[model samples]
Target: MSEIVLRNVCKEYEKGNFAVKDFSLDIHDQEFIIFVGPSGCGKSTTLRMIAGLEDISDGELWIDDQLCNYFDPKDRGLSMVFQNYALYPNMTVYGNLAFALKVRKASKSEIDEKVHKVARILEIEHLLDRKPAALSGGQKQRVAIGSAIIRRPKAFLMDEPLSNLDAKLRAQMRIELAKLHKELETTIIYVTHDQTEAMTLGTRIVVMKDGVVQQVETPIELYNHPVNLFVAGFIGSPSMNFFQAHVTEENGRMVVFIGNPKDGKKIYLEGRRSELARLRAMDQDVTLGIRPEDIHEYADAAELGIEKATVGMNVTVTAREMLGAEVFLYFDEQKKTHAVRLHPKNQTMTGEKIDLYFDPKKIHLFDQNTEESIFYREETV
Candidate 1:
């Protein structure tokens, strides 16, 4: 079992300036963990600290109950796959795959067997005899992975291994990597800035910002119940929409007005959500958060029994994207552009007026000053 733990880990480049601050996580064995954030958020630095490539300024690094903060990278038993295919141009794929084993003085037969086995698993057997320069981008990546697999390390640390590939190739490789993780059944800690990769690949994703970990959760949980405004805004493509809102008690129900109270753009909260919001934000300003898919058209609103609550939300379509499977409509509200996903048959053209409704149950409320989700459950964190 390759359980890795970081206890209040930090990386300081200058006095009082940390690249990674108070980062702590317990990574389970064979779990595909992803560290994801925007660039310069200290994700890569945290990965490097785990890999022993960078020094941990504070806190403890433990690998399987052994303190490993001072261990050499090679002795830590972790294989690293970098973004750049770090294969030797002068060496063929087979040679590159066998290099690690040969460095340990393994016999030729053992090296050959392991090399062939890994090549078959990565589907690079046909390119074994070709040098790095002769292989395509995908092929070279496969070779790089095969090289790492031959060592049979305790865990794999990958730093944006597919960032260089095009969109189509990246999609294909994502599938391949998932299959590889299952077959190998080894711990993998991958780092990437792409949310799509994090959502699809990781069993548990670590969302970081400015050297601090914001939340760690499964993809669906993170998407559905983000802990704060930053996470809700960061995880999804086109992200969550936010509007200035105020919460008040109206007719024995908690009501959230989207803009000015006179505009009639408001949503009604019911049952437990109403109780929670009323307890935390009654008669206070809050930010209203809703996903694009949660905002629906007239027919859907009627079906969901939220029609009256959406009475006066009239927005002019500024942009319309017909993405075949689903339609996306963009509109301006309170000087901010908001998006809504509709059925592909949504005939709302650019410059046309459209009425949209929010599903009351799907609404999220955040504290205006703290930006923390008022409805976030502490148990999930």
Candidate 2:
């Protein structure tokens, strides 16, 4: 329903601690933008600033194309759903939903209509007469959301609204929230530390760390093509494995050196010869990044390029997780360990050793200093 923009926004507390710094983002109308990062990453603080709950120490805040730096929270036409379901325990669900309108002395018929409409949308109409103590956690959360919805504000700001729910209920609420977004068509700014929630719910994700915005893109784009080491490591499950490697020219070809002098191995990457050449020319030591799923067990070493520089290393399988369709193989090799995703059929017993191959094309190379992707080209093949 409204666009929110932050231009060079910053927040600083006593002792020169910066909570958020030089942050600028444009959230379009009806878009669900999720701010995600680890705790103390300034995501919640940023949301509070946008909601007019915190003063902007620097820069401008705009809502619906209007400068809202000095505006009151209510006058900004934004509704916020907090992490804790801040429902009045004494009030029934309907009363909780009607409180805001009652404070403004809205007509009795108008209040009833708005509250019931929101309850119906949230599917909590049956629980309207029940107090918070009588409602389940999910029901209470729905009432909290309904309270925000009844206001019909220009935008919705939710800060980890489903954090208190159980895992199963969380999943259900996630779907319901997505449905709510579609039905309301209002700009939503949600904050969460959970990567799964951020990935599944966001139309565009703003990945932040240490008070700085790392990447702002679609979920798939961030997952497939992260901008830096932090985003790469933070955005995925079972996180991408990182190995310090040196880039060297071997026989007119670029290769990344993996493993140490003791039980060492060298992996050669075929594509992006030009990019590797540039990095090598600059004498840069690159970090090799590969997702667990990208490393595959070779059925026939001769069928592929596995013989070129493959090293025979002994891995002690520590644990195996079977997820029906796929299995996770966790193992240790040469004092270093990693998780390799494999078919459920390939679920090797603990202490068993298996041969695995790393796909060069699926590997990512990042500049050691800048931590930016240097070897992976974005142009579609």
Candidate 3:
């Protein structure tokens, strides 16, 4: 198995600064793991440390049963695909793919066989005669990937290899890469700033922030159940909306009062007995979170068979964005701006006031002080 382990790994530079802090994870065989965060989040830094391109200031890196913290990149039984296509500008695709084998002193026939096999797998056989200058962006990337896998390394590490492609090509290559992972059945560690790429490509995603690991989970889990405010905001496109509210108990239920009750922004959380008890016990301010998909108009909820809107608020459509199948409605309530998604067919007009509903069961509450999800902390505790 090509399982890789990182134990308390850290990368520190001058002046007591660290690029990665106490980073640890287990990447199982044939698993696709993505390290994702905003720029400068240390994802690329971590990948470089794993590839032996950067020195680890502390901790251990193990591949299979071998300690690889001090091993050379070539000796670590791993190959990397980089963001920039590192193909030789002076050589043909065939030469580039066979470069590693030539360096290892493999026989010419052996090199030819491996190169052709990898070219076939990457669907780049037809482009073998082309040089880097002659290839398109996507084709050059394919050649780059083909060259990396030509040696049949135990594991593959890719650092934002698709960032150079256009949106259409990026999407197409996502599918191709997914297929390659399945066929090759090799462990993969990918680093990217794109959450969409992380969600669609990785078997599991590691979300990071400020050079620190925040959460690691499957994409769906990270989406439906984020560990903190950062994960909840980063994992979803259009992000989750947040509002500061005061929690109080009334009539054996928890009422979250946000903005102003006079403005119709107050709502009660129901049906969660344990959560209610916890909220009632806390006299502190809390942050309320709801995804755009969960905020809907009363009629919209009923039409979609969603549970009846537990909380009602009157909001104005400040801005409207039509996205073919769905629309994004931005509004302000209780002095806080928020957005809700609706079917485009609903014909919502800007500047119009309408009553919207929030699904009580779908709401997320976070501690204002820690910015951690209350639900997540409760479950883990």
Which one is best on TM-score? Answer: 1
Please write out the lDDT profile of model 2 over residues 1-381, one tens digit for every residue: 588999999999754788999999999999999999888999988999999999999999998889999999989999999989899999999999999999989999999999988998999999988999999899999999999988889999999999999999899999999999999999999998778889989999999999999999999988888888888999888988887666676676566666553345666656554455455433456777889887777763336566455543356679999999888888775366778888787857898888777766666778877888774354323
**Model 1 lDDT per residue over 142-206, tens place:** 99998998899999999999999998999999999999999999999999878788999999999
TM-scores, in order shown? 0.98, 0.92, 0.94
- Deviation from truth (RMSD, Å), model 1: 1.2
Over 302-342, each residue of candidate 3 has an lDDT whose tens digit, in order, gives 67554342556777799999999899999985476788998
Model 2 per-residue lDDT at 6: 97
TM-score for model 3?
A: 0.94
Score candidate 2 by lDDT.
0.83
What 10-residue stretch in candidate 1 is worst by lDDT? 372-381
Which runs of model 3 end up more than 4 angstroms from their true locations? Answer: 261-264, 273-281, 303-309, 334-336, 377-381
Which candidate, 1 or 3, would have the higher TM-score against the true structure? Answer: 1
Clashes of each: 0, 1, 0
